[model samples]
Target: MAGILIIAHAPLATALRECIAHIYGGCPARIGALDVLPDSDPVEVVAQATAEIERLREDNGALVLTDMFGATPSNIAARLATVPQVRVLAGVNLPMLVRAVCYRTTSLDMLVEKALAGASKGIQAIGPGTPAPEYGCSPTPCAEAAADAAEQAAAGATDNVKAASGLSAGVLKPAGAT
Candidate 1:
């Protein structure tokens, strides 16, 4: 099993773990985190993250997830990647973390793919005719529709919320646009 090491800005990694606990009842073994504060020492964080990764890795490889590409957490993760059998992925999110936990028993490469898929699919924008949040509407913001909306916007076209109006008519529609 590949160990999960979440390295992120202060409190984010911890909060993500807590969220997982809240949803699943308990934290799984081989999953850990390193919270990098704004004023923390970069070199020290590197050393600490490396040691933590080693501890979590145990007999298996480790999968590290950082908040963003060029931030402190990611920089430390980059350093940790020098360790053998370690993988680092940026854009740590709730969906990605949950998915990583579920698939942590797989190979590091496969875990990375699963985590990315979860993160990408987890993001969504509001659509019209979607039930109000109180009504329990499921949202699925299709990327192609969003891109098309952007193109329309750049072309000075007005967006009408009718794109997703079919939800109330038993005609399921893609999110963001028709």
Candidate 2:
């Protein structure tokens, strides 16, 4: 199984871990969370993070998740990319973390794909008019709605690309005033 490390601003990393624990009823092995404090020294943080990476790494390698790109945690995570078998992904969210934890037994590359899918699939517009199923209120119904939404989103993206490139199989709109 691949190891997972979460590096984020103070408290976010630890909070995410705790949330995962809450969901899973227990914290899984080979997972570490590092909270970077405001007054943290980058060099020391790197050292500490490197040590965590070493401890978490296995045959399948380790995955590092950070809160935001271009931030301190992600910058620190960037330094660890040179470490063999470690992949760093920015924009850490609950869905992404859960996916990474659940698929820890898979190959590192496949785990990355699963994590990315989980992150994107987890995002939705929830409002008054949105269906409860799409809001993930129930397991089976939510899964079905989510699957249908994913399919539609994919097809819509394809159509959008085609239209943008003037290759759509439909009448092209003439440039005109709104």
Model 1 superposed RMSD (Cα): 13.4
What residue runs in model 2 are displaced by over 4 Å at the alpha carbon?
134-178
Model 1 lowest lDDT segment of ten: 164-173
Q: Mind giving the per-residue lDDT tens digits that candidate 2 earns over 1-178?
A: 6888999999999999988777655676788999999999999999999999999998789999999999999999999999989999999998888777755655688779878877887789889987777645534212332343346556774543233222121111212301
Instruction: Please give each candidate's TM-score.
Output: 0.71, 0.76
Worst 10 residues of 2 by lDDT: 169-178
Candidate 2 lDDT: 0.76
lDDT (10s digit) by residue, model 1, range 1-178: 5788999998999998787666555666777888999999999999999888878894448999999999889999999888898989999998788767655544577668878988997787758864556636533323332343456556766434223122331112222424
Candidate 1 residue pairs that clash: none
Model 1 has a clash total of: 0
